[model samples]
Target: MHQAPDILSLARKAPVMFNELELLQYREQQIPGSVQYTIHRYRRQSQFEVDDMGMLVYHRVEKNSKENYLELRFCISGNTYCRQKEIECDNCRFSLSNSCEQKSPSVDVLSFLFSPTHLSQFINGGKMKSMPDEIVHFRHASSFSKTLTLCGKTRTVLEALLNHNYSGSMENIFLNAQMQMLLLYSLECMIGEKEEMAFTCKFLANESDREKIEKAREILLQHIGEPITIKELSRKVAINECYLKKGFKELYGTTVFDFYQSQRMEHARYLLYEKGLSVTEVSMMLGYSSISHFSTAFKKHTGIKPCELLLR
Candidate 1:
């Protein structure tokens, strides 16, 4: 692998500018096992040069370094290590307590390795709190299923681009589409752990106040299509009507009825956009007895008629 300089030479050709000296300084501290590889225009797909096991290995940071990257890693053949604050995803640790094996050797972990600039685009100015001095780890986790997940079709499109297998506007289209797919995939994985934790904590909070809020959420989730009243909703979640109204907003940041409406609208959006369901069909599915009522609510919430949005 050291004999191959095609892509490596391309990377070297783009001399690391003076302004990127900080990144260079950080890169110098990488672990002994780490190596940097680049993919530019090469000729053969098979010869695009992966690790011995066919993984595209780019060791971007030192093992002990505190730098956190908006990173995507796949454990393809062996156990790997990763960490970020109090959160831990350890396969061996998780498996010692339980007896299940991970489904695949190659498992994808993303979102944590993203650069500060990339994250700031979505999070405003808040990305730097978790800064260059924080040791982010992504150790193997037992729960990582061997699903055929791709970070973006970009992994595939990137492979194509690196191999010089295609050309013209089609190449540009593939790259753009793949990049978007990869970005979405990275975002999804990045939030997966945090979202799961928040959900679990909210649903399982020992405090009565939080439980009541969760129950209120459950009621909304269960009866999204029903013309449910605050009074009836309070009864279902086992809370007083007044507390249901006020306590729910305090915990969830939204009124109980507002949450319920949001749930219904979200379901309607998924049906219309993802499942290709008809507006009337979705309206009926959600328990709305009348198409006009569903349409009115949908339009009121989304600012566009369901029929018009459906065409989009």
Candidate 2:
């Protein structure tokens, strides 16, 4: 199984490369501000290709030459826009055949990229009878909240895979199993729309519910530094408070309040461990108003006081 890098130790290994020119270009165009960590740097004119599955991370990808193996790109943290065909600007797609393709007006995002072989293996005997044009159509349209929910789940699995580095450990196997799940999910969303299949429809309904709960979670994340109430979350998502609470708990396997608190504590842990922020500073930043309350909560969540964690 994979373990996340000791971020503090890795920080000392080498600072991540940042592209100032890219940042300026995006900023000048009024694009959404995005902070990037260059997890892998491709050397100029590199041409090596391998068939085996490998894990990699990149900032932005562009296809300058004829494509080799089919590429799958999944967004782990942020949003991306791409078309079926290549365009000159960022978020464009092109077709080698016919030389005519549509510029992607939006992004196609998932957290994991699967090679053609991998995808073929998934369908068993290379039969994708269920997913024809609809697969691309649904992905491009961003229609069906079910699709987005699956994308988020794919991201989670990808995160696990990257952290584990394809090890043969039990955790690695579990991650791979989850990846298989994401594949089935995408397949279901694609073909399920075309047919009235009972199982597929059932899965789609479940996915839709999960998507709603995720929206609620996103709202909570946006307000992590401030106190967020269930009513507030329900109002923001335009769902009834009672249903929102029930759905949030069922989808996320935790109550909305519990999940919200976990997110805040996790954010605080990142600040303390990664940014080396002082306990008082973190407490204030997270809107505790009182350091004593912050410490109590922190200790309850992590089984260690904020100050003690900082010492470690």
Candidate 3:
């Protein structure tokens, strides 16, 4: 495996100028099968208030039998507010100098670089024609890039990668598994777009209605702990309940109830395994009325009870 560039080097190459850039975390490993991957978490803040910023990463792999590879990048952005409102200074939030209570906008980026040989193993038993372009073209093109939608599933995996408690070998195992999942979700999002375009609901043809449906989905995510009714969701987004349901299913590839339940269960599993929270605590945090009810619902979604998962 070749050495990849560090986060600071990549940040310096970005198009937008940032007042401050910090590399919060970085992890890299080479597995037994010659698979090498790296994770970079960065916090960036700009002084001049820009609408958008973009980064460009350029790398040249060492000459070898394997010349092609794939790169996956995920970015989550949010604002960080300071606790104290009175004290304020220029560049206080962006700089590490003064200890002031303030919140500023920050962007976190996670990137995964996969080797060609590692990816090729998946197609080793089959013909190249049967494989997807993302796989087949890895060996054909020098470099290519595609913008994929950051769906809910993809966001969940990215969040897990950002916040985890594993270390050493356990960390390596967890990262490798999550990287594969990111790849799977990316491919699925790409393929699902094609299918969606072929059979999109006519109701979504209107841009305003589509926005309303998207807003409804966001509301559903916000209230995962305490789910809202379909009528309430429609009212919040100011769209008809029937249109919201049909448009949501058409756009997101799942019903509202199923999506909400799946998100809740996934969060439950995260709280149990990662946070080490007790089943009862997680059950209550998720607004479950009783342990047995939570257990039954968890088992229905995950094929195992919460207690069983905790025991693992």
Q: In lDDT terms, which candidate is top?
A: 3
- Candidate 2 displacement at residue 98 in angstroms: 55
TM-score per model over all chains: 0.36, 0.43, 0.43
**Native-to-model Cα distance after best TM-score fit, residue 151 in candidate 1, in Å:** 26
Show model 3 residue runs off by greater than 4 Å.
1-14, 18-20, 25-35, 44-65, 79-105, 129-142, 194-312
lDDT of each: 0.44, 0.47, 0.62
Candidate 3 lDDT over residue span 1-312, tens digit each: 222223332334322312245655466667655446555444555542322111212122336545556666655665333333235455453464345544444556556766765666666564455215435335332222344667777777877876565778887788778878877777776566645665357877665677677667667767878858998988898988888888889876689898788778877987987789999999999998899999998899878889888776
- Residue-level lDDT tens digits of model 1 in 1-312: 001112221223321112212111111111122222222111122322222111121122234323323333331212222221124336444644233243222212121124433334454433334312221222211111111234444365434433343346664555444444554554454445334544323433435555565556655666755667887777776767776676677555677776678668866877877689998899888888888999998888777788886676
Question: What is candidate 1's TM-score against the reference?
Answer: 0.36
Predicted candidate 2 versus true structure: per-residue lDDT over 1-312, tens digit per residue: 111122212222322222211221111111112111123212211222211112222111123212112222232222222223122432232223334343112111223444333433433444334433323222221111221223455555555544342434554456556656655555554454436533322332555554566667766877878898887777876777877877766554578887677668878988988899999899999999899999999888778899987876
Worst lDDT window (10 residues) for model 2? 23-32
Ranking by lDDT: 3, 2, 1
Residue 135, candidate 1: C-alpha displacement in angstroms: 22
User: Candidate 2 deviates by what RMSD?
Assistant: 17.7
Q: Which candidate is the best by TM-score?
A: 2
